[model samples]
Target chain A: MKAALGVMALAAALVLIGKAERPETGWSFRLPPGFPRPRVPADNPMSSAKVELGRRLFYDVRLSGNGTQSCASCHVQSRAFTDGLANAVGSTGEIHRRSSMSLTNIGYASHLTWANPLVDGLEAQALAPMFGDAPTELGLESAAQLEARLAGDKTLQGLAQEAFGAGGLTLDRVLKALAAFERTLISGRSPYDRYVGGEVSALSPEAQRGLELFFSERTECFHCHGGFNFTDAFGHEGAEPERKFHNNGLYDLGAGAYPKRDQGLIEHSGRPEDMGRFKAPTLRNIDVTAPYMHDGSLATLDAVIRHYEAGGRGGEANPRRDRFIRGFILTDEERSDLIAFLESLTDPEFLADPRFGAP
Target chain B: MRSLLLSLALTALPACRQDTSAASLSTHRLRFIATLDGAAANCKSLAAPPFRLRDARLFVSELRVIGPDGETPAAFVPDSRFQSVEVALLDFEDATEGCEGDSAEHTELVFEAPVSSVRAVTFTVGIPFALNHQNPALARAPLTAGAMHWGWRGGYKFVRIEAQRDGVEGRIHLGSTGCEGALHAITSCAHPNRGTVHLELDPATQQVALDLGAFFGSDKGGDKTDCMGEPADPSCHAGYRAIGAAGKEAARQSDSLAANTTNPAMGASAFTVIRRTP
Candidate 1:
């Protein structure tokens, strides 16, 4: 009896130590210099198996309602995971008011979408494109049909079970896998990134001058788009979720209200003050994600810069424009230089990496 | 030495087997349901008075009861997946059972404690401030699964009641007001604004029915369903009246039932009542 009790004590100690140990073993990620690890939910710990399964599901056209589109369809890896469309067309052929957001470095984002404050993590945000009925994207919220679609394929089912550990083909497991895979989409090997590190020579002389103007108080561009990720809204383990939203003077349809249908955060809050507020997406791979803003009304990056140059394009000078968005005159050389600095944010390696490509 | 250790281990094992207090335990599975106009509530009726419940989610915490053995707080019977000490969220809208939007048939708040000597049960309507602002990734079930959380700055919605009367949507979203703090943690809130409900009954043989009909005074399908934490707003009339009757509007203390007094919690008793089983 005594021997058994002693063994039990040792086993208990081992179990306790295991519980305290870091969940990230093969899940560990070495983020770029100054970049922090993204916060992983306690319930859904990061694992290689889960991410591997997610990568497969992300590329599988069968995951869609009609089996015609995958997440990779709208989010092409070569274009930095952006669809490069003025307005995102849903899998059901519904034209969305906004463009598809780039998935590059989305793991660090605290606020996931253009405006909906309720959507914070990648797990919940995936539900929108997957199941939203108003403008159905993938249209796979119904579990029975989704399971039936993936049922015959033994390989996909095997991967699902391994990722979820016994919950055979459930929505929760699907969501967790997708979230885990997205968290691994880290992009920090750009020219700007090298300059941020020790190598100041990574950037050209013109680009370096443009960088000063971008971060300088004169342009006031860094107010909303600051930090290493180039967005004020960021979150990591142990740190608070910086859920920041802003109206960058994109629309001014008189009375400070944006276009009726495209009035960003105000649609949820119903407050005039919150009219055109939307999440400022990270500029990690801004070159490919053109036709910007919440509504994707601005056709080109040059048009976007010019909009800011004139302060809140379209209609009269809106009252709801952000305080930092004061119209400034830029010379042709200065304008081209600003564009050059934005171009430096593109991570070519991330776009070409076969790891993120369709399986 | 081995024998001594074996005896000790056996003794401790039995003692540690039970997590709660070392008292006589009686497990009671409580069922919570709502009624409309003194009848069983239905949100799917399509006639002149459509009884179709579009959405209804209630968040109640700090549950305590005065039992035959005195008073003790009721701790939720923790499941293998999630557990909590003080708060309980009772969901009544399951999609199949006439509910339009939701899918879960989770209408009961289940909690266990030694309550054989119990005479009455008490609970609050909203989340406590201590746990409200904590990291959501770390919080369990009701805090996580439910759509109660209203972003970092705004905090959780105490009671999210959305119903359609004659195809019109009426919503009441109750939450903490004058809250100022960081995104993750709200350090302080001027008005906790939570409603307390304490009912006199025995769980072993009786049931409790909360009449929401009294709460929805004149549900004319108007936009009076939304309450943005304002006391004077017309949309909050039903909600304010219901919360007011549950406790002493002046004092948030569980003991302040305010049975005889005007519920100082909100204003008028709106449409609120506590029915007991014989």
Candidate 2:
């Protein structure tokens, strides 16, 4: 009897994922210097075991209803976790309205999605791509079908049992585990990150000058793209998540309006003032993530800089055009400097990390 | 050791809710039967454009049987996973005989309730703001069905109906909007975007007639068949009225979910309630 109890204890100590059991110190975070710890949900606490299991599920195509795509399908790590598509095409080849955003520093996003104000939890957000019907991503018709598919996979079934205790492969547990893995995606190893860490020699003099121009009143880029993660929409525990949405004069249909189908925040709020407003994504990997904006309308960083310089682009004087987006003039040298500064934010180690790669 | 692992599996799994409503005497069953034009409607008939409804699902909550003073109390199932104070999620798409992209069929939302102090019934047309943000996959009964989950930030579509008219596809997705806060909690919303439906019902009746004929009919003035939750949009007028909005312009608002206290002359629409019958 004593031997059986000892065996059970040993099994519990070394969870099925072959990782350390819940240690006395709990989940140890390896966040880079100067970054605060991210706040995780009470229900879905971060666990190394959960993260390990999630990595396997992330690469497995079987997670999709059609067994053709996974989370990694759209969020490729080499391109800073963005699929490098103008707009995301789903497992069934359905075209999504918006381009895939980088998941580099997703943990710090105060709000999830481009325009949605409601989806604040990563667990809840996972359901959209996995089950949403219209623009199908990882399409599963129903929960029962999902359960049956997971139950059939012997290896996954075993890992899920260890991660969620008795609740093997539930949609709740899957989402929680996926979120736990996503929270660990910290990227502060770029040259800019090193420069910010008291190593002024890390950035080229051109990049250093570009950094100055980025924050200068003339450029005014920092108004929306300020902070360690480089977006106004960032927060952690106790810090009230900065809720902001802006319409950078992206469009004007006759009377200060965006296209009817893709009206950004206005579609959710019904307030005309919110028309054409969208969430400002993290600039951590701006260089690699091409064809930018909520709809991927802007093709290059140079083009983006030019757009800001031109101001409204004669879009019928949109009523809700962001005050900060009012056009600024810049010389050719200044444009290159700004682009260099944005490029300095990339963390090469994060882009090529084998751990984030497929198992 | 093997037995211990099995026990863990049993505890974590959502316990199968066997109709076991037969276990007690005081408990009575509740069901939401759907019909259209006074008959079992055909959701698939791509005759023209808007006339063909490829699929449809509606989420109903906060069911209350009115009494002399206000809402009366009843013996709610304590073990039920989704049983809020006095709320339930009624699904109509579970009956997937003629639907597209769906396999599991739920004919009606059937549950157990203590049939006492019941008179008129009142419910909401969309998901309440408080319960709208939580992980729907973790919840039970209707929430577990999985078809209702829409976009993550968008949450569940309170009323989602899809159809193709003149080869032009139209869909209506209704739910709370302009809400803020984390997924676990929402601090506030500029527009909660939910409408309440009140019906003068008798206690003897067990089912409410859910007719969708008027909901599918074409509104000549409206631009599209869908009401995508925009305030003052031309599309929401017909839908806002059909679900119980009496006022033309003010009844169905895409911009504000706040009740119009200033305009007392305009009456609220009570469209979801077709009739109360046994």
Candidate 3:
């Protein structure tokens, strides 16, 4: 009996030592020196198992209702996680209200969906694409159907269990896993990051000038999109909490409304003054995520800068435009330089990283 | 070994006993009922003229209870317990489903509370100032669900009263006004329509009734207004003003109902309270 007890103790110690010595197999993420990791929920703790499961799910077409589209369908990694569509088309052939936003550094986003205040966390935002009836993507409203769909694949079941203990069959667990995977999709190794990190040769002369213009108070680009992440409203681990929204005067069709289909935050609040307000997206890979804004009306980065330079859509036509959007004209050289600066934000390492791509 | 186990058990006993005592002292049940007492207004559609309350749904949140003894300042408690109270909408019965011209009925909001230790209870007609100032991410329960959780508006709706009035069915939704951008600036934003009301938790008068008639009747000229649709319309603006006035009056009456037993307030007198069998 004494010998058996000794053996048991030895095995337990070995297990502990093995756990301690376990090499980190997953991606190694580190926020910029001055930056911080975005706030993550306690319920969905980050782990390598969960992140791997999320990555697989993100690329899997079976996640959609018709098994035709995956998160990757709209968010291609080559394009910096944004499909260059004017507006994303869901699996059901329904056009989305807005363009597909770039997933680069999305973990720091305060508000998940465009113009939606209710959805704050990535776990909660997963519900919009999975179960939202109006623009159904995954169509996992019925638990039974979701269970049946997931049950067909042994690999998915194993991944789900590995990520979410024994009770990993639920929709909430799936979403939590997906969110965990998305949070790992960090891209901070861009040329801009290198420049910020004191590397002199990181940016060319023209790109440096564009960067100066971006941070300059004259252009006022930093007012909306500030901080290391280039977004004013960002929340992350150990970072000061900030969740701001703005009305850059997207449009004032008439009668204190933006447009018929997309009224932004005004429809939710039922306030007249809240018209044309939308959350400012991260400009980490602005060159890739084309068709900007909530409606995806703008097609290219040049067009987007022109829109801002003109002060907003209908700047000369509409009188009720936001006061901040006093149309300013930029020189032709300045426009090219701004585009170059935006291109500098692209992390070549992220786009070429095998971890983000399919096996 | 036995002695050590016994000592640990004995030491843990006090904590369990203290928990029971604390729970016993702070668990009281309270019920909030909004009674609709008026003939339903016949309306064709939500946008049509003479938009009346054919069918209406009311969503209220930020529920709180204020004790008459005044021990607790107007803080937001999960359950109604003492001199301070504030509660907002969580959910409501859809009024649009009912037949037009039917006599409206009362909807009961029943929840468990520990209010025996408190003197009086007061509640905000809308969400509390603190909760309103918080990010929508922080708001859980009652406030998170229903129409009150308007995305990006920065605050919950104080009152969502939908009614079909005079052949025009429309909603009268009231939230914090003066929203500039997507992010609600707590200091800059204004909720002119928001007000507070108090309820005296007397064993004699346990039940309270909130009437919808006064809200509709208060705005005499803005009869054809609809605050739900076409928010920029003059009629809608006038209707909002009328509703805002009525909410203030109702709050004043509710506050008075807590203090005076014999002389009930305008809407308080109509309420019938029944004691639960002990």
Candidate 4:
């Protein structure tokens, strides 16, 4: 019995020694050329173990209260993290008012979701889908319920232990892990990116013309959907977070109103000037994450171009429309060229990357 | 852990009241109750035809007690979950039947005030501007409650009165509207939506009564839909009128609370003060 106890003690010491030798590797981003390091919260630093655990949780259906769906259900990786639906459907079959936003370079966004200005951090934003009841996404009733579900699974608990160092699985830890993984969904390898990287043949002549139109003052597409991430609502390590919302004049119920249910920034601010203001989503992977607009009212890229060309549904009569959204005439050839340029923004390699996929 | 903290708070209350120094600070407890036309009502027994209460909660702040001399600021005693120095949350729903958030039932506002005969009281039914737009994930209790949060708009509902009448659900969520600015640098909210209530109460008043009938009443030809506190929402007229915070130009554009529908000639208060028998 004494020999058996001695052997057990020896085994414990060996395990401790093995753990001490196998140090955790520090995480570093293989950022695309010209891309800056994404801004991370001071509380949640990046780690390989945490990101791996987050990837597993991101695809785990048990995260939902009913265990019917996961984050991947609405944010499918192949479709640039959007479900390609007009409105997102929750785990319990409740239809959401807004569409699923693409996760492509979401870490760079100064704000999260379609319109909320306050939700800037990914950790804070993760709480909405997991426990938000206004058309519940993950449909979790409470944090205790989520904790119980996560603690019940041995594999998940082991992963949590690795990521968070023997601390029990918790909501804050889960959110941090999920956010760490989401930050790694960097997409900057499109044909447009290649063209910018000195690859002259990366873009066709038609796409090149479309790109010019997109950047030109006539279309003014680059005004909002500009910069490396193709959006004005961008932030990085040393940059002051940009908060820009515009009214594209999608609808005019009466007196420059866009649907009563969703009046964009006005719904939050209650200011008359903010009637139809909405964030211009990153144009990266915009070709796949359709239907377009805040409410997903527009069907295709052609329809979007037409809406912009016509100066929105209300035309010049829309009092709340952005100054940049003035009427512009685009030829059929120019329109098709613009669509081709948007398609060029799609990064096939990033879409098919196994690193961002379910573990 | 929650119940233990609550018991600690309850235990601390009696000790505070035991202080007998002349003209010194003493704890004043004001219990709140929901009523269907002056009759006590809750999630379990709301009304006939079965009115299912989903959520009923409101934030009360800037509390002051009216004395013979003047108004005295009644500072809320900081509690573990619901009461803070600046604000107090009165949650009625018990997470039974249709109720879907925190099961903790909080319906009292305990505050420290100078010992005096309280004849009336005044307070605002809304979240303070400073704490309104803060990140809820990092917020302390009462503010951290998910059901009370208006996530899409980035604020807490100042007043949430939700129920189903004959299987048809109608919800009234009142919060600041036209709120502009980033999380930290909030410029301003166009419609602050903070309802100011001044009630005349007897010294024996034990409960602050909220009339659900007045809240659910529709002045616009019985169009009882969900009111998300949007100025464009015609459905909000009834709620705003009931809360005595409605303005003629509110639906269009006006930030004047003086132009509210609460007329002096009506002689009606936003909330009625009553004494509930133990």
Candidate number achieving the greatest lDDT relative to the actual structure:
4
CA lDDT of each prediction against the hidden true structure: 0.65, 0.66, 0.56, 0.75
Q: Model 4, range A275-300, lDDT digits (tens) per residue? A: 88989898989999989987888999
Q: Least accurate stretch of 10 residues (summed lDDT) in model 2 chain A?
A: A11-20
For each candidate in turn, the interface RMSD (Å) is 7.2, 2.6, 8.6, 2.9
How should the candidates be ordered by lDDT, best one leading?
4, 2, 1, 3
DockQ score for candidate 1? 0.04
User: What global local distance difference test value does model 1 have?
Assistant: 0.65
TM-score of chain B of 3: 0.53
lDDT of 2 by residue, B1-278 (tens): 32343234324434322123322213334445556556644443333344455666676664544544344323224324334333445544533433555534343433233233345665566665555655667666555636576555445667666666555556666565555554445555555456566666553454556565555455541335656644355665545555543242343333322432212213233243344454
What 10-residue stretch in candidate 1 chain B is worst by lDDT? Answer: B253-262
Per-residue lDDT tens digits for candidate 3, residues A99-185, read 888888888787666776555677656655654434445544233345567776777778778767786455556677889888877
lDDT of 4 by residue, B137-206 (tens): 5677667636677666667888888887766777888877766665433556667677767787754556
Candidate ranking (TM-score, best to worst):
4, 2, 1, 3
Question: Ignoring the other chain, what TM-score does chain B have in each prediction?
Answer: 0.74, 0.64, 0.53, 0.80
Compared with the true structure, what per-residue lDDT tens digits does model 1 show for residues A48-121? 78888889889988767778888888899988887888888887687877888888888878878787665677
Most accurate candidate by DockQ: 2
TM-score result, candidate 1:
0.62
Better of 1 and 3 by DockQ: 3
Q: Whose TM-score is higher: candidate 1's or candidate 4's? A: 4
Q: What does the TM-score come to for chain B in model 1? A: 0.74
- What are the runs in model 2 whose C-alpha is more than 4 Å off? A1-27, A197-201, A237-239, A315-318, B1-39, B43-50, B61-98, B108-133, B150-155, B187-213, B220-223, B245-278
